[model samples]
Target: MATATFHQSIVSFASPSSTISQCGFKIDSSLSFTSKKINFCKIKAMASVSYNNTLLSPSKTIPDNTLKKPNEAALILIRHGESLWNEKNLFTGCVDVPLTEKGVEEAIEAGKRISNIPVDVIFTSSLIRAQMTAMLAMIQHRRKKVPIILHDESEQAKTWSQVFSDETKNQSIPVIPAWQLNERMYGELQGLNKQETAERYGKQQVHEWRRSYDIPPPKGESLEMCAERAVAYFQDNIEPKLAAGKNVMIAAHGNSLRSIIMYLDKLTCQEVISLELSTGIPLLYIFKEGKFMKRGSPVGPTEAGVYAYTKRLAQYRQKLEEDSEVICS
Candidate 1:
């Protein structure tokens, strides 16, 4: 077999001093094919005025009661676990599908990976697969806080689902389901097998259909079109929570996530073309002082420097391990 070599694209910065903290999340970084370093751009800092896209202007003042401790701001993004379509090598797109057995296991494992992190809010696409991933991952959270889906569909629904006691509300995380966070519409390819599609269309054509930034697949959404909605939702809904210093976890599909990542990392059309994500893996970001610092996922209990940013994560990890040992014993 011929050995295949791969290259890691590095995002370029004007200078080393240009930390993500100083610049708004809209990074001025560009991908360099020859570079081996991994570069990340933060989401453009929130502004008083909305950008040309669907972003709405943030409130000028946060209520005194709304201010959380600065260190509490964190963000976690996870692509949902494998679905039946994924197991069958089909393009899932926006079709509402359930997880496969392997996907259920993946969701459980994903929960363990971020068991120590604090999650004050949850966001997911209004699809079963994404919803299942978020709920299953929360199973191992050290906080042991239950996740309650918020039902704000109507005044009646809201009133019916309201918790009478404040204590109960405080103990649970709100999981908000939104269609804007759903996966890219895969159009006519929704149930088709990937191999067959590639066979029908040439491999290169299929690759372009799958990976190109602006080219949509046979009436499906292109990455650019997906970003118009996904990133907009993040700016409008998710970022406000982070701006208020709340830790948020978003469970969504691959293309939707890639769209948000493109905004956060400031990937250009060419750069985002090759971006890919693995299912059930959570990526972390630290939000403080109105900026986001990308912290790659924690792969193990003792991964050095991973826990240094948050004291709560380290303490929770220790407690989780002790609890696990007790269960085994």
Candidate 2:
């Protein structure tokens, strides 16, 4: 394997940029020197000091232009990049397929698109393709936080991987893999080529099987049935985190993501049938006050110059950029 070298630097308060002046020498960033490398680096601010004693604490005052909002959370949903079955135009529902090399690149690009967003937790399906997408995208995160899978199946596993230090826990993102997030099981059509199936069964029949929300194909789970489990799992496992003001990133399959999107956007069955999500594109939503507000898709810096960031997202991005520039300078 080829190796790359990275340089990490800390930004002092005396830097030219005044935005990070109050942070002391807390800002951090890194740059790598290599041919085949992601040229991005994550900058993190050091922990702030707080006094516990009332007598010793300074007068509590809110910043004049602070953009931080309480009880507001971010949700980023991404369908896994193209799988081998996808390349072959096969019915890949519930099948364990790995990503193609192109898929790998797509995943990385997807990560870069949302790299500035903070991700507190990650969720993915048990299938390797979704799992791979999650891991690869995280590699490009601007936070530089390591993502560790939580294998709490057994007491031994949980105990062995447990973190002993609070600081270490703060620097890592927990990954949870669940089968409930898996793709709709295609049943008898699992390994069949989509074109061949359509030809054999007639396009109308195939269309009904593929696009009809309530119809299941030959012992398979319909999109409605799939949504029942997928949405429930999301509500039970993922919703509470957002409710608690934590940003979450879910790397899941096409149908599963579509189902979740349907719920978030309040899309009608007829409307959802026409919705098509491209491989590796991310959809963002701001969850606040028990409601989800769609932030649409983030257009990466290259393609659109500016992401259609909500007020909150724009502030968040600006804060990170100032901190990053300080550290890199």
Candidate 3:
């Protein structure tokens, strides 16, 4: 196996003088993509990714500058792109519509905005639109790690799909599809046209059904009802993963995400009603010290604010860029 060792980190986030002692992570000094083994494998258990997208080992070295926040983890939330029903102005609810062509593009675009971010695990709703969005977005990630849908319905299914190779498993990201994260059930209004429904039910009544925090549409769920389940799932499933230092990404519906955002941002019922999220945009949050701090949406990878918000992200970006340059050199 071909290999190279660096006594010093040739790639630095800001300075050219970074040495091995200053960098806690293991990085092979020069690139030989054809190398049978890579430095990424050395820290695979801790970094949770391979060299396809990141230059660092799975156990990413934490820079001393951000040493105070060792438990910091990234949290990304993206609503699914426009679905076919969305294009038709229909009440999709939990109907399971696929994305429109425009929706596909939106997903790709959202992926670019957060392409630099490292995601350890992904969670998507049990609906196809959300699943599609998550899959498409990952295609744009710098790390070419595969996102595998974990099937645990039966022991046989789980055993049959196992990747026996340690390197292969470390390079894969687990995608968990959960019914609890599905969009709020619209009940009787699931397939109805939004405009027609409003006219049939009177504008005032329809407005209340759609926007009121506690009111339901016919037999459908209210925003409050959605929150009861969505937020509970967030706390029980997603939050603990972040608290454990795992970077996470969630792709779901507008209402489901809105409900979670309500909990994260501590939005009032009235305030959440006024909050708006465009389809396919990714919102970034930092989880540290048992609290979530909103970092807002990243416009693109070129946006300095997003990458520079933390030293780890900057180092991650710099390392990958250097890897690309070494290959081309």
Candidate 4:
């Protein structure tokens, strides 16, 4: 409910100035109390005093000039918005699914949320949904002149922009497609509906498949496996950005993001499984000296906005059900 209210207020800030001016608030309070009772007339009497104080204040604003823009040692992790598989409650695994119409809208809104932030580099998986979300976000930043730089295996660190300058006039923003960043491979569970999988494999087993760190689904990867690749890639590719003082954004899947979060937050495998990532929401991280310094809360339309969107989705689902019932009748 609080999130819903927040989302509603956030959505109203359509203008850049309004969005930047929005203030955050908090309340604090303290209390102390004591009591003494005497029984019978002969008993001695005691006195006690108590004091309480409370302070509530709006979040302090850091002047744009005074506030240090996040250093180049920053990373934004965003789960690609809902895909067709997500709508069907199917296991997407490593399968590439296109974003549904609503998913596209979510990505657009997410893009608008961080349009003003200076993002120097963008990272994405080979999957289309993640790639599309990254592209939409980049477009929102009005970086149309930046050309995508593709990294290939044979050349390893080949800078595609330099090579393709003659082919395309636009200055390319380097786009590095890496397999290490791909979503957890679901293996045999990839195409199965969640309910069906639960029924066939039993709920507990299915839950383990979905939530366990070391337990791979059939022939698929465990969270640990995903993290291994993700961390490796992060160190090899993403670490350089931070060292160079560049802000980076990574668009990927829930599992992949979880992998990175696990490393950054120092969460155990079990804990990582419990972490939730909302689609299209950005998780910003700041690093210093090859270590995490801080992480920014997801900045997006308020919970109210997400609730509104969810409600609309529910209504659409209900209408489809009703239509199907009518046809059956």
Q: Tens digit of lDDT per residue, candidate 4, span 118-138?
A: 566788987888888888777
Q: Evaluate model 2: give its lDDT.
A: 0.65
* lDDT per residue as tens, model 3, 5-111: 11011111110000011111112321111232222112222222221223222224442223124567789999888888888888877777889999999999999
- By the TM-score metric, which is better: model 3 or model 4? 3
Looking at model 4, residue 4 earns an lDDT score of 29
lDDT at 141, model 4: 65
TM-score of each: 0.74, 0.72, 0.73, 0.65
Pitting candidate 2 against candidate 3, the one with the higher TM-score is 3
Q: What do the candidate models score in CA lDDT, each in turn?
A: 0.67, 0.65, 0.67, 0.58
Ranking by TM-score: 1, 3, 2, 4
Provide the lDDT at 173 for model 1.
91
Candidate 1, poorest ten consecutive residues by summed lDDT: 13-22
In candidate 3, which residue ranges exceed 4 Å CA deviation?
Answer: 1-69, 307-329
* Global local distance difference test of model 1: 0.67
lDDT over C-alpha atoms for residue 276 of model 1 = 69
**What TM-score does prediction 3 earn?**
0.73
> By the TM-score metric, which is better: model 1 or model 3?
1
